[model samples]
Target: MRNKPPYALSSVDHALHLAALLQQEGPMRVTDAAERLGVAVSTAHRLLAMLVYRDFAEQGPDRRYRPGKVLRPAAASAAPVALLRELCLPELRTLMERTQESANLMVPAGAEVRFIATAESPQVLRGGDRVGRSLPAHCVSGGKTILAALPPTELDALYSEDDSVDLPRLRRELALVRERGFAINDQLTETGLTAVGMAIKDAGGSPVAALSLALPTARFDRERLPGWVGALSSAVAKVEAALSAR
Candidate 1:
């Protein structure tokens, strides 16, 4: 038979490829979708944005895109802990590599945040691993990020009748977090430990998790604050992407 060239529209092909991914996976980020389709981030972003506009896909609070009502989710499911731990380990590793600091994943439990995964830095003076530990959600960076993503009524309920916390002050802090898009802990949880974090959301757009970087006070450079925030944000995005796959 005579040879014939295959017909393809690159843009449409990429969009259909992304739709297939959304059907097979749960959610995905622009970077991930771009890498998967071998395209630029801007191209992938535009495609996903168009999908959102057409109601073929939806963007979650974490800024990841998932299959919209036009598509059905995969049926596979796993225990929450198992799925979370698996999803976060690589993200924590990525955060550690980016910041050379301890990286931790946390999930909210009522008024507390439980450490679900931890990747500690190699430096001798680095912050310790906090896996399997729990702390008040309103105190640490990760926990505060999660709390700040909550509804006003839920937040008010969380702090009501708590004598140890200054509700007004906490509210102001959360307001600042929403404005800044990330949370910071300047030795608030521990005397010499500092951290920055961003909230992680599920396909439904609820802040179910947080990704954070823990740094020793002496090594936490204020000049590099923006870089650190970027790392944390990237980590959360990757985590959301991975979670979608599961």
Candidate 2:
């Protein structure tokens, strides 16, 4: 049999392919997608711009593309976290009211996590982390929680071969998170702070984000950790159920 050139896909087909790729692969830059798709830079940009304009994808602060709120309905029609923010807001607000600690919704973005939404507690001493801030995937509880939900192969691809703390360690920690059903970080990103996280899944049982509570280490004791974990777990479950119902 003679070898054949790769089949040339149409622009529409390419656009759809790009959307699916972004959805599966998480956030990526246009240049990276262009290189992977073997398309011209201009072609890739055009496709990405169209997706962004239609809200099928969102452009992050780092200029990478991720599945947008519009894609959520098709991806998992139940709960629609993007749309349910309104519903979640009340619960999140209540959480803040009770705990007086910062709460946030974190979505995975390649090797990083992006804060999609946040609620600040009214404590007089409270300072805030920006809503759109991006943090290293290995350093945050939310990042680890989402990472734990990925398959072993995907986890391996995320980390190094040696299983060292560099990349492999991240995979290993994620494995631990899967075992534990939650993740905790003690000042990994900053001093004197801690965070507890639980993964928020869609109706399809895919982890789309993490819900976390952040507090000061001085005030957050081992005795209180379970309560914090329970609160986060309850909130995540509520969000997951809401998504599933929708």
Instruction: Provide TM-scores for the models.
Output: 0.66, 0.63
Error of 2 at 15 (Å): 34
Query: Which tens-of-lDDT digit does each residue in 104-188 have in candidate 2?
Result: 8777766667776778867755526536566766789888888788777766675654444576556677778898899988899
| Candidates' C-alpha lDDT | 0.82, 0.75
What is the Cα-based TM-score of model 2?
Answer: 0.63
- Where does candidate 2 have its weakest 10-residue lDDT segment? 72-81
Q: In model 2, what lDDT does residue 46 have?
A: 95
What is the Å distance of residue 70 in model 2 from its true position? 22
Candidate 1 lDDT over residue span 151-212, tens digit each: 99989897888989999999999999988888888897789998888898887777888888
Deviation of model 2 at 30, angstroms: 32
Residue pairs with backbone overlap in model 2? 78-243, 78-246, 79-243
